[model samples]
Target: MLSTYVDLAVGLVLAFLFLSLLVSGINEGLVRLLSIRSKFLWAFLRDTLDGPDRQGRSFLPAGMRDVFTALPFSRDARPRHNSMPSPAVLSPIPEGEAVAEGELTERLYERVREIDHPKAKRTSIATLPPERFALALMEFASAEPNGVQGLLDKLKAMRSPLHGHLQGIWESSAADVNRFRQQVEVWFDAEMRRLTLLYRRYVRWVVAVLGLVLTLVFSMDALEYGKTLLRDQAFREGVAAIAGGGDQGLTALKDRCTATGDSADPYRCVTEALSSPALVKIFDHALVGVAVPQNGDPQVKWNLGAWWERLISPGHWPGFVLTFAALLFGASFWWDILRRLTGIRSRAGR
Candidate 1:
């Protein structure tokens, strides 16, 4: 009986891992499709270059705030920024022209804004590396014959927080370009860490919504499945056998699909592996309940009607909550638990 309980626990973990992996795959697709990393990088650049106004709002023109998303991944990136500042904002000053004492910040803002230019057919805000950003800033600041020294002179003359910030980086570099570049890289990394937290917050909400949708769509009632697994020994044992082999099987699939040298689309490869016959069989045996049609019961079809009926039932609320919460813990968490449970089951069987 204790062994049976362990098997039941393994089965539950296996199911949760499966669903969590599915969520992860879908999230990966969304991330790629939306260029989420690029968006966040652009946000970091925008906030850094624009600084803040007296009102504590971004110093960037109000119309250009969402320029981070004003790329292809955004909805109507072109049309949305029709009211943005004109090309003159980003146009570089002619050579040998007199640039203002503290105009480096303004120039930096213009270069960033160029990434969101509406008429530019090839503009893209790709991920900006710290080294590349530092190089660009250094080059932009060296408007006169004096290179690094001229850059430092401009930074010292600035009146904003950026002035103090860059001045500190300059002093720490001992007037060396390479050291300055390294210092800028460190600063960019720190700023990017903040961006990561903001991005994760956005992804957490996205996952919650996606988890709820998938739960209802698939009628994955955790409580009902738990009851089924506890009561049905044959079913429990069958799933536990699969769970015992879970690690090897999943690793093989992940390698063949995602880690292989030949596979072009890793996401599609993962989806195919997950939907393979063996994994499908695991789900088929596990989701057995009223949702499963009786053998030779022609009138009872497992269709949308059945799924919707199961989904809306009030008795499944506890199961729904449990399932949703489990999914939020993610695939890696559940996979670890499944492995531990499998190990325990193996030891117990001996």
Candidate 2:
């Protein structure tokens, strides 16, 4: 009986993993389609370099700002049609503080030219590494006669909070050029971590909204699904069996697809993996069995009317909320739990 309960729990978690995977796919799609990474990066860069003043004015010297304007990632360097709301409009950054991650490198510099310069084409860059960003900025500073010192002077002139931060880093290194660069890289890395946290927060809200919609559309009442798994022994055992191996299979599929040197389609590999037969089986078990026809037909017909009825049903509300709350844990979280539970099941079986 305890084993049966474990199987039931595994079955329920497996069901959630499937739903979370679908939601993750949708979130990734939305990110790419909207160029969310690019816009966020741009905003972050703006906040970092320009750092708003107490009066909310840009601290970036006009000369330095012009240099930034010429950079490939800058709004001025791209087509106007590709523009998003200005950093100020999106959200105000703290004075002297830059917003997020991405190394502004010579490669991105060159790539920007290839994509846009000589002719205004393409939207914006999707990613930049922190080390690359530090390298590129150092390269820019190298052009100055005073090199790193000249850069520090420029920073000091701004009297922005960043100047104080960089000054401390500079003094900590005994004003050594190479040490300063390395420290700057570390600083950028810290900023990137903050950016990642911010992005996750934004994604969490997106996931919540998506989870709610999916719950309603698929009639995935978690409470009902759990009850079903508990009552149906054969189904519970089947799900447990699949859960034991699903993670390995999915991981293998992703590894294979990613190894194929296809840079143009970042998600094609994932799409292939998610469309596997195992996922279909999970989907069928989770959603198809949720509702039964009153007329004794085995086929579960889903329609607006049926969905609306469920939406209005007071009993279904808890299920909807439960499902939505479960999804908030995200696909990766569910996958990890599924992997562990599957391991336990395998050990018990042995």
User: What's model 2's lDDT at 241?
Assistant: 52
What does candidate 2 score on TM? 0.60
Reference-based TM-score, model 1: 0.60
Task: Tell me the lDDT of candidate 1.
Answer: 0.58
Cα lDDT tens digits, model 2, 1-350, are 78877777787788788888889999788766655655565556555654543456432223322322322244322223333322221111222345222222212343233333221344466456667766655664665567766666756655534567677887998978788889988998888788767766766777888888788777777777776565455433444455686443444343445675664343554444333423233334232443333357556543666556767889988987888889889888887788787764545456
- C-alpha TM-scores of all predictions: 0.60, 0.60
Task: Go through the candidates in order and give each one's C-alpha lDDT.
Answer: 0.58, 0.58
Error of 2 at 169 (Å): 2.7
User: Candidate 1 on 1-350: residue-level lDDT in tens?
Assistant: 79778867887888889888888899878766655555455444544543443356542223322332443244221112232453432333333335442244345534454345443342244455566667667665554456666655544443334556677887888978778878988887777676667667767777777888777766777877877666454433444455687443444444555554675564565444343423233333232322333245534234565556766779888898999999999998997798677754545457
Which 10-residue span in candidate 2 carries the lowest summed lDDT?
86-95
